[model samples]
Target: MDEKRLCLAHDDSLRMLRLARRCDDLVLAPAPARVLRDADGSIDPAALVAALPNELFAPTAQNPVDLRFDDDASRSGCSLVRSCPGLLRLPDDAYLEVLTAEGDPLCVCGSTVAHVLVEAGPLAMTSAAVTLGRAVGAGRLSRDAALVRLTGFAMELCGRYARDPLAPLVGDVVHDIEPVSSVRELRAFLDEPTGLHGVELARMAASYANDGSGSTMETCWYGVFCLPPRLGGAHLTRPLQNVALDWPAEAAGLVSHERMRPDFHWPRYETACEHQGGDHTSEQALEEDSRRARDYELCHIHYLPLTKKDARDVNAVTALLAQLLSIIAPYETDAFARRARRMLNDEGVCAARRVLLAQLLPPRLRWCDGDA
Candidate 1:
């Protein structure tokens, strides 16, 4: 057939037919080469008859010849004269051997796992963590296996060269998955001989990670507070989270519970830091805060309640850190004193702090030359 006639025939076939598969020079069965109903749901016999090839109309009983279209026009060129209904219904990751107009085998809507990971970016860690948690919660995955999987993803993502590595974020994800592993388990993972990227950062993050954190925001607060001051951080000792406290009998009705557990605490100084965000605005929350404050006063422990705004303000955080440091200084151990002395003179810490500062701060707010 002439090229024009072939093109016209293919176009007409595609309009009504769903191409199942095309073998070498043959269009196989199940291609559905007929439309029995019109848009108004009326049977169109003439339309169906017209859609079928001449071979189908003149068919004998036995040996049937498969319908064949011009290979040059349908398979070897950029022609939209073929439709694959199966391909349309499958997912983007599904693999199918489809031929281009040039008759070259091409993948239809398939992509690698690495490509999907790259496309997801930093949220991939959060997503994987959340998914594993849900799976465990639903009893689909065991808690131990889920922790391994979560840590595996953390290893993969954090090892790569990324600004917001998975190390720091994995803790919150693991926390959400409940019955989280001990810090020892995380350390064991870190010690394993795996080809994980960014090992140093991963180790550092694991050192500071704790399942005791109540929320992602609490994790963020912990991270920022541990870094040196030059990096928009407080350089404070890592505080224990959600430490249980005994409340006086008089506070039983005023607070929600007879016992109190502060959000973050320094046991050495008996100082506690409470992070008050929108959840503390209720009347019950106000009463609880008041009762907690009175309880701390009775116990002779310092209480500092901070808001999100306090955490965001660099100067405010610095001042709060100073207060914490002063209170804890008297109780600082010889070992801690030695570490503090070393920190003051450590060039490596200074360099690392500069890199961390760049990562954490916005470009405009970052330290410039001689700005301190």
Candidate 2:
């Protein structure tokens, strides 16, 4: 990392420390440098510490002599080292930053001259994956959900925001985090016996995790299609993401010269679905889309185009899904509906389903009456 970036990150860290000081019980944990930098860049300091307890650490001296402050209290960094009885032993370099009641910095812990660096700055997908892996290992979050969140966050940074330089780095990091063949092994490693949240982690790992999603909308769409019927989704088979289509040699001129990777594909039904964004409005993009559709038609594949409006409009998306499900398996729609009804009896899961549905469906068209 450059000195300028490091100084900015340090300033952000100090800002976080000031906010954390306002809550008497909260203590800043030793986080990866990327986490600190991203936290500094993306979220407010107060919001970052919102969930932490006010008095997480209490002042304690490792040696009694060090606790005595002569004329300069600033010299005694030990004044801020609180020894909480149940807290785990922190790293040797870990030191608390003490601040006044009004959020002014008092002094840094004298035990260490500076904060420890865990990873490089200039956040990348690998940094996110590492942070997520640690969070799962520590039982702070569910593995599947954390992966989805990480992928979505990285996509926003690298794609929608035009951070083009980070694109290749993000792809490489994602590959390292979730190789095509070792997804199960990766999940196992993330959920290894931490003895704290092992059961929850294992459960989440067992649940369907669509690591293949390429964007935030795709991730959300995947959840809508693959989540169990009990969770207000169709519980359909997982779709392959970014699959390439082989076009006939004569039709090569029609397809986009760039690439022909479909957003989501169902191999068994020879069907594919694409979620079109605002970029599709251009004449050139529309021409490309029509060519792709023609190619799929020629190959006897069903092509479905889902617009951003459709994604946000629950009635439209679900209606289209129901039609597709009927085409896929006419007899199974009733079974899926029944499962959704059973899910409604459990208030907790039903509430979660409602929250997810609200994101994909408009308020008036949101799922109700145990409808799938």
Candidate closest to the true structure, highest TM-score: 2
> Model 1 over residues 55-154: C-alpha lDDT tens digits?
3233222422122232322331212223112111211211111233454322212221100001111222333444566677799865444443343333
TM-score of 2: 0.48
Top lDDT: which candidate number? 2
lDDT of candidate 2 over 226-325, digit per residue (tens) = 6665444666787777767776676666544445677788878788888785499889998988888887876666898877656544455566666566
TM-score of each: 0.43, 0.48
RMSD of each: 19.9, 13.2
Model 2: per-residue Cα lDDT at residue 187:
44
lDDT of each: 0.41, 0.43
